[model samples]
Target: MHSPEIDNMAKLWDLIGDIRLAMFTTRHHNGHLHSRPMTTQNSRADHDTKLWFFMSRHGSPVAELTGEASVNVAYANPGKDTYVSVSGNATVVDDVAKKRQLWSKSAEAWFPGGPTDPDLALVRVDITHAHFWDVHENKLVQLFEMGKAAVTGHPAPKLGRQGEVRMA
Candidate 1:
């Protein structure tokens, strides 16, 4: 069996590799969570981080961020049986240079006018922490815990506490 730390890291790596889309949740002015589907723009292994999207200077999401920067981003891959939720603060970046760097042909499908569109805005969420559950592996772990419980009469391992990390 792998050490807990190694197993957790492997799960996280697998989760990111398997998930291609993420749902971004931001707080509306009235305090309800507003969620929208966002394509996974990029993932940086060095930081164990991922970036989701937005049109640079417009949308209710950008406006909401101006007032409250806290947000939640989630990813799921049913085929891989993995899920992740990241909580962090988002900042609006209008750097033309960054816009140029991240621009791609695929983005044109949504933003017809391209990256130069005046309304295009970027919301960069610097992930502060995250929680993940790998149902594929956790199921086996759960079975083990259940068998142990039947023999020793102890409670099974708690559900949904598979792996997590806090950014420094």
Candidate 2:
């Protein structure tokens, strides 16, 4: 039998495994939330509690992470009706080996100087909690369910699997 923790982690991974980009949100010094699209660097890995990204040291995200470690990364695959939101603490890691390991030729477009570039920054987010929604049925079925619930004056039928996983 699988532990509940393992099941939760597996479910979380199943929701986000194929999504490459996420909206990484952080709080700025002025007390405002900011979000930006970031390509996930470690999604293919088996690790369930950490997410990685390559960024510019001079960017606002790096500065924000320095000020406040709390952050949220959201992943959505509308085609598959899957969405995930992950909360974590973010930190800038100054590990060259890790940078090299996650490095890709496509990254050169942003950091022209490659992994050894002084401006390149590696950010790691230690996931604390994750919430996910995955709809297994087709759109037509979902619409039918909603319509039926509305006509019956009952709560909408559960159209998907939704759960939360605490990792910290």
Candidate 3:
């Protein structure tokens, strides 16, 4: 449970977990932004505001972040109509225990050496701020509301939720 008095990172974790994948964007030295799909390393632990990801140390994202840590991760679920955008500073760390903990058979396809692969690196994004949009009502109910509003010459009802989490 979360109270309005404090923004909870657990709630943010659940929201990000629901979406699963994030478009991790990083700035290149050429002053252009690049984005790549990344799977969030979801854990049961109540992380304050840090998100983890596994990637090859040789990857461009890792290289780019070495110079500038500022980055953004976007998550979207069109079917559920939920979306989130997070701004953070990413730092690469050599935490063998964490790599082992978050490891899975699926990751072996990328790093054949398994969790002990030297090329494999764990990047932690220290979230400074996060924004999310979600619809609470069922699809049918939301459609009905839209129809009603249209017939009454009124604006569409805002049936969802939106919030900003300043975690940093």
Candidate 4:
């Protein structure tokens, strides 16, 4: 069993694990933003939150990020009613050793050439800050607060957006 605080942190980690798909958005030179769903190659928590994703070096996203490092990563799990959005700078890494360490069979699906593929690229998102709302408990809390406010003729406090609210 975990303490209340630990339990909450564990829940957040679970939510992130449940949703492996991330919508990565990047800005183009022309000032237009592009968003695409990319398979989360791997997600591990280190001293800092690091998300690894695989993409072709020649892909449009890669080209866009080369010029502009800003990006937004959004994840959603409808069945679990969880969502996470992370905003950070994307850095393109083509280190063969690092790619080998992160490579897996699933990645082979996209990169037939494996980690040695000259076109393979890794984008690492260094999350600065994140916010999350657990609908499971938040919905109940909201109802309770609303009822109390109704009886006391007071307004309920505003809640931030669901998932990781990144301000960068």
Name the best candidate (by TM-score).
2
- Per-residue lDDT tens digits for candidate 3, residues 61-135, read 999999899999999987888889999999998989888888878788889999889899899999889999988
What's the best-to-worst order under TM-score?
Answer: 2, 3, 1, 4
Candidate 2 per-residue lDDT over residues 26-103, each given as its tens digit:
999999999999988883664577888999999999999889999999999999999999999999999999888888
Candidate with better TM-score, 2 vs 3:
2
Error of 1 at 156 (Å): 6.6
Better of 1 and 3 by TM-score: 3
Per-candidate TM-scores read 0.74, 0.93, 0.86, 0.73
Alpha-carbon runs more than 4 Å astray in model 4? 1-12, 43-48, 137-168
lDDT of prediction 2: 0.90
Candidate closer to the true structure by TM-score (higher is better), 3 or 4: 3
**Across residues 1-168, which tens digit of lDDT does each residue of candidate 1 receive?**
776555545555566755657888889999899998876555454324435465546588888898899999898876656688888898887666666666778877877777777777766887767798766545676688789999998887665546686663
What lDDT score belongs to each candidate, Candidate 1 first? 0.72, 0.90, 0.86, 0.74
**Candidate 3 minimal-lDDT segment of 10 residues:** 1-10
